[model samples]
Target: MKDKIRIGCGAGFSGDRLDPAVVLVKDGKLDYLVLECLAERTIALAQKRKLQNPAWGYDPLLERRIESLLELLLEQKVKLITNMGAANPLSAADKVIEIAKRKNLSVRVAAVVGDDVLAKLDVAALSLETKQPLSSHGKIVSANAYLGADGILEALKTNADIIITGRVADPSLFIAPMLHELGWAENDFDRMGKGTVLGHLLECAGQVTGGYYADPGKKHVPDMVNLGHPFVDVFADGSGLLGKVNGTGGVINLDTAKEQLLYEVVNPHAYYTPDVIADFTSVKLMQQAKDRVRVTGGSGTTKPDTLKVSVGYQAGYLGEGEITYAGGNAVGRAKLAGEIVRERLRHTFNEIKVDLMGLNAVHGNALHSTEPYEVRLRVAAKTPDAALAARVGEEVEALYTNGPGGGGGVRKYVHEMIGIVSCLMDRNLIKPEVIIKSI
Candidate 1:
């Protein structure tokens, strides 16, 4: 075998235009395709969907799309990797298997999981940065760890035509196969670095292809409905080139790629990942014209001493209904009324938290931990669902008191009980015990 590989990234279920993106890669004769669909909100969305109908969510959506792609890949014999499993990669695989059997495609399917750790956070543990115990605000909410490139490697080993995973690092889907086919070890820093950078470049798919680049005006965007998914050509030496599915929406020139690079990376020289800390400072970029950018010249080294953990703590609900101000100092009147409500609640309740939404400069120092502002407020607290929390919310609505300094009936203001859940995680736990089974 020549050991050559090309990778693509994007969701298979966005609009009616999903087929064009995947079929384009099949037509292009690429060796492998990687699709990523898991987002921060995806876990919750999946849970909600499952709640309504236990058999629904990202997995089925992904399975249907993969079936389409698999038929084409089988016709051309190309492998694939994806994280469309969202919160349930296994369920996604099962669905794909069923579809394959029905079609008599016999396309081998592999699933990578243990990445969706939405249920893993321990409130008693402190944050790596703040060193404070996590709040119980969202103690029972969702959390998922970002897996690295190894899962894709495992998929390739199965000789499977398609690999499905949940919440793997967006970049890993592209890099893992290249590392595996080329025989890059767990510690091959240089190659891993190249793969990591390539993954990051194409992870957002069309985003790097001028989706959010600010350069092209909205009216001038290429085929908005058929946005192109990203792809990369990795060489044996760990060097690579990035592009996308043919005839798709958006363009991937140097400017757009550079803009995507700046989207999240703070320091180019020290791009960190769960598997390795890649040195992107040595990287080079060149504008290869309207729809292409040439990325080269980057090196990698062993990973950092600490693994990054993504923690999601309990943050309470936030509700806001607008109230218009027409009178003189209407904002001031609202502020005073809010304060009175907070004071009354505090006086009536013990060990309960309360705040007046209109009177506090929440966006200022009070909420942001910066310098306090003179006016502007949003009430919230950790009090029980019924006590000060709900009471304070109701108080904000009762600001139209008929007493002194109160005349204009306060418009019904939306009251919300807010809890604090920190979604930040930085704990690294590699080398976990994997209990694999033949499905």
Candidate 2:
């Protein structure tokens, strides 16, 4: 059995930088490169696209990413894995073929499907959060379970060059290759848990490497625009050394590592997953050198009887308008403009959000300030009908000639909103399988 394997994260989310991944492939000495690009609402958004055309539910950036990285990965003899096949892995697999064929390169591609359980979902079942059923939503769009590593492993067994998955657990995508490469038994809980923590750290790609952790001057990071992605030298014992590539512009320290450790961690003791009941409390983090950390010792409880599923629904439509005002009493003028929009759309829309940008949009009037040269009044609303939502922009645009003086740079936009609901279901309800097509 191989004692060690290196896995580097190329794209963290759907819109991550592409150039940094090329650096990783060229210099990281990796066995596998992973791209985790799915978010809770990403699949729902993809489903909306698929409704318009059956062949288009996968990640929108799949083709671009493959074209950029295919030849480099092929040269390095590194395998690739991704959840870029957001809602349609099969279509994504076919798209990869088209990209590869254009470059005159042959590769094995596998699609991991069956996470979409919308057809089998019980609409009447109560939610895991609000105890409300799926019937309460305006309309159902997509429901996908967080699949485990079985399908990914099944694909790797066929010696596929790339594995595309739909709705797999964020960390599981990283864990499968470790388990497969190291010859770790599937039932080994402690090793899986340890490997999972490493995966979690790298899953967000740059987050663990000072991309999101950097605060200019306060928690300063040098050359953050060209932030480096993370890769782990994983050992067979379920431990790994975390570090970024050399000649990159990001810091990797205990602080960055610990921040990512606690991110999105609802319960430190019970970090639930489809594969195992991962316990983060047992994991140890030790900084052995600059931009390097030694990770060891994580254990897991028994696997959960139920799996958490994310259900997406057609929530409503959102319409928004923004107008900027500068010089002398800008905040006051913006506030007045906000009131005008609220009164105009309050009766028609379900919810209206009025905020003054650059002042209180993020904290919500907490740090009220009057000394400001410029302010932007943004009015937005959500409604069942797109027409009503569009009214928010129309009304805000009217402020240019209809009262608030100095209101310039008017912009308006409207888009469909997708909301997510969480639920738990029997593990047997959904089965994930690998479908392979070689070119």
Candidate 3:
């Protein structure tokens, strides 16, 4: 078994920068490269795309990413693992094979599947969020279980060059490599927890590398424009050192590591995942060097018997319109425009949100004290009927000519909104399998 393995993160989200991933593959000398690109609603949106076209459900940037890094990854012998498969892992693997063939590179790709649990889902069950029956959510678009690292571990055993998966837990992508390379037992809860800590820290790619920690003068991050992603040197005992590529424009000190550790963590004592219930209360973050942090002291209990399943359904449609106003009481004009749209749609739609962008958009009316020289009037509403939803933007666009005198830069948008809810399913109900394709 290897004493330690080096892993690097590429893209954090679906639309993350492509250049940083290229830099990591070319210079990081990573044994494994993980791209944790799937979000709760991303796969749901990809399902909609798949319904429109069979071959287009995966990540929109998958092709470009594969084309850019495939050659370098092959040259460096770096295996890739990503949830970029989104709604379609099989087709994603096929796409990777096609890219390899086009570039005259021989590579084996593994696609982890069977996360879709819609057919096995008990719709009568209550949602974990609303405590309401799943039937109340209308038409179900997708139901995917949060798979763990077992499927990925199986894929690694096959020596695949790339492993693509659908709806796996974000941290599991990073943990699987540790478990495989370090030869850590699947039931080793302490090691699993430590690996999870490393996975969670690096899962967001640049978040632990100062991308999300930047707050200008307060928490100033250097080279914000050229922020680098992170890498971890995970030891067999589960401790790791987090750092970034040298000469990259980001810091990986204790502050960034600490901030990322608590991110999205509802309870630090019992952070649940597919692999184990990691306890982050005892995680240690010590600055090892200028841009490196030594992370240790994470533990966990047995894996949960139930897995979280994200259910996506047809929520309805969202109609939105924005109009900008400048000079001479722009906030007042924006407020008046928002009020006009609200008044028109209040009776028709149950959920109408009107806001003055510069004045009361984010913090609501509580922070409405300051009036800026320019303000934007945004009116949005959710409705079941597409025609009614279209009327919301139409009314806002009409303000350019009739309601508000100085309204300019009018923008209108109407799209179907996917609603996401969560439910727990038995672990045995999910059957993850890996399919390998090669060029």
Q: What local distance difference test score does each model get? A: 0.61, 0.89, 0.92
* Model 2's TM-score against the true structure: 0.97
Q: C-alpha displacement of 125 in model 1, angstroms?
A: 2.3
Q: lDDT: which is higher, 1 or 2?
A: 2
Model 1 per-residue lDDT tens digits across residues 224-327: 56666677777777777777666777777776777776668978888877667787777778866566667787778787664454554434433322222334
The best candidate by TM-score is: 3
How far in Å is the alpha carbon of 425 misplaced in model 2? 1.7
Clashes of 2: 0
Using lDDT, give the best candidate's number: 3
Tell me each candidate's TM-score.
0.71, 0.97, 0.98
**Predicted candidate 2 versus true structure: per-residue lDDT over 1-439, tens digit per residue:** 7999999998889998988888999999999999999999999899888889989999988998899999999999999999999989999999999988889999999999999999988888887777889769768888899998888999999999999999999889988998898998888878888888898889999998998887777897878978899999999998989998998989888888889988999987877777777889977889989899999877776777887888998888899999999998888899999998888777787678998888988888767756568988888888878988889899999998885889999999998889898888898888888899878
Mind giving the per-residue lDDT tens digits that candidate 3 earns over 1-439?
9999999999889999998998898889799999988999999999999999998899999999999999999999999999999999999999999998899999999999989898999999999999999879879999999999999999999999999999999999988989899989999999999999999999999999999788877887888788889999999999999988888898888888988999999999998999999999999989989888999999999899999999999998998998999999888788888888888888898778888888888998875776889988888888888888888889998997778788999888999999999999999989899999988
Task: Locate the minimum summed-lDDT window of 10 residues in model 3.
Answer: 363-372
Q: Which candidate model has the greater TM-score, 1 or 3?
A: 3
Q: Between prediction 1 and prediction 2, which has the larger TM-score? A: 2
| Prediction RMSDs, each to the true structure | 6.6, 1.4, 1.2
